[model samples]
Target: MPFALYLLGLAVFAQGTSEFMLSGLGPEIAAEMGVSLAAAGALTSAFAVGMVVGAPLMAALSLRWSRRGALLGFLGVFLAVHVVGAVTGSFTVLLVSRAVGALANAGFLAVALATATGMVASDAKGRATSALLGGVTLACIVGVPAGAVIGQLWGWRAAFWAVALLSLPAFAGILHSVPKGAAGGPGVRGELAALRSGRLRLTLLWGALVNGATFCTFTYLAPLATEVAGLGTGGVPVVLALFGVGSFVGVAMGGRIADVRPVPLLVGGGVALCAGWVLFALAAGEPAVALVLVLVQGALSFGVGSTLISQALYAAPGAPALAGGFATAAFNVGAALGPWAGGVAIGAGLGFRSPPVVSAGLVAIALVTAGMGRRVWRERVGSVSTGAQDK
Candidate 1:
């Protein structure tokens, strides 16, 4: 990777750390704030809602500033929010701080994706995007585990302090590293035009379905490890670590596979994800099988990100900003829906493993959609070729 890309990755790492570290500290936060685990979990939901609202709002508003400036501004906002979160005494205040942090995060990620991809050659776009997103995957590997340890050793408040401290250097890195590119507002009309495209719609659908499925399984992963897999609280960290490792591997492989064959890679990811979910649902009663299935599911599902983003860019050729924003929105939409859906199943006495079962069903539907998209692409190409032959 280039020097600038490396710096951007660092920023991404910090952002990822701040965002995902919440999962590891959930129990500690609940206890510290004198709230229920479910209430603490709502912080995650609030973050997703902020992303859904902020991505486009920031993208559209940032048109006047250079991408570099936009990134820097967003990071500043992120830092402020984290600082507030760390210092606040009230649970409501903390919740608001996290929500604001999420809102800032939307712009940070959007600008990062747009900038990193722009730095590379056209053919390397997938790799570039993956490299940036890989930082997020890596957070699961490093930051989440580390945060959990911090919370266990020090306190949940200390974990937020750690996030804030870590973010400072990342903020500095962005100020020094990322370069400015494309400085014009893609007004509401331009953003709307990109959304109107059929390919973009398919991209959004693919993102939402795949991410929702993944989150449904992941949100209740701890419960599955405990209730179904017969693991103790001590085992939760280990299971999460294994899943993170799988996600890291998946992100790397997804980059390579997307470069080779974008659509086919997506199809393959969908297949693997469905298989993993099936395995999880059936074998969750066995500790060993559940552990293995979690890793596999993480690997397969998160790996599809490259294909989904690539499809969005291909579908909306000239408007990357809008595509970036919408793709992110789709991701958050899934993120918001997945946990709730899984929680409902769990409440209904289906057990924690039920999420994986339902997620698998959703992925199966996505597979059919992917096949339909492939057919449409082929027919369109054939018609154009036939028309040209007549000419």
Candidate 2:
């Protein structure tokens, strides 16, 4: 991988810290802003909504712009918003800043994905994608916990300030490393036309379903660890860290082979994920078992999820810029829906373990979708071959 890809990953780490750190600071934010806890939590929802909307919108808007220029512009916006969020007195201002920051984050991620793959060999796209995504796993492991600690020690505002400061190096690196005038795609019209491909559509659906399954359980893991597994509050972070470790390993290992053996890896990982979730739900009362399952589940979730994302990019060859945006939108759709489904289950008296069960069902559906995607891929390839023969 190019050093530039590592810089992109570093940028993602800074953005991802802002994205996930809010989870730990919700209560502090609520107290400081004189709002309900739910309202503070809504900040996260606002970010998710922004990401879902911004990915495609920003990608299209910047499709013809210099890649380096777009990346620097987004990072500048992200840094400015965090500063605004840190200084804002009104809760409304903070909330709006978070959403705007997410718009920039989403745009950066989309462009970074296209940029990372472009820097690598065609056969190594999966590895390039994983290299970029590794920053997210690292943020989950190091950045979020560090941000939480910073918030707990100083104040929530300090955490926001930290995110702003952390992004400075990334902005500098991108400006230095990324080539000037490297526009993303052929054009907006060409990208839009590529969206009509059946393979691309199914792959995007696969990405959504796989991610929905992962987050449905992951979003509620803390409660499940404490209530069902009999762990104390102190143990919750341990479980989360363990999951992050497993995810890092998964991405590192799976990236090596995902491009070469996408079908087997996808099918195998999905099946394992479904079974792992089912087992997790059944063994929720065992503290030791729950801990181990969390790690395994994280590995399976990210391994398959990353592969699906890489496949989406491969599926949309004609839409280099839009492909990353579509993949971003797909994953965020699941990120939003998965937690909602989990919340609905718990709200309806299904209990903490229900989320894992729900995840299993989601994975099963993903498996079926993967099968349909395989057929579509085959048909598309066959038709192209037939057209060539006729010519």
**Among all candidates shown, the one with the greatest lDDT:** 2
Candidate 2 Cα outliers beyond 4 Å, as residue runs? 379-391
- Give the residue spans of candidate 1 off by over 4 A: 26-39, 180-188, 375-391
Q: In candidate 1, which residue pairs clash?
A: none
Q: Provide the TM-score for each candidate, comma-separated.
A: 0.90, 0.96
lDDT of each: 0.77, 0.87
TM-score, cand. 2: 0.96
The candidate 2 region of ten consecutive residues with least summed lDDT is: 382-391
Model 1 accuracy (lDDT, Cα): 0.77
Give the per-residue lDDT digits (tens) of candidate 2, residues 11-80: 8999989999999999999998999999999999999999999999998987868889889999999999
lDDT of 2 at 87: 95
Residue by residue across 1-391, what tens digits does model 1's lDDT show?
6677767777778777877888768988898799999999989878888899988787677656788888888888888888788778799999998888887888777767767777776556667777887888888789877887888899888888887787788777777776545454465576566556665677688788888898888888888888888898888888988888888888888877675577667777788888889888999889888888778778887788655875565555456666777788888888878878888988998877799988998788788887787644333222212221121
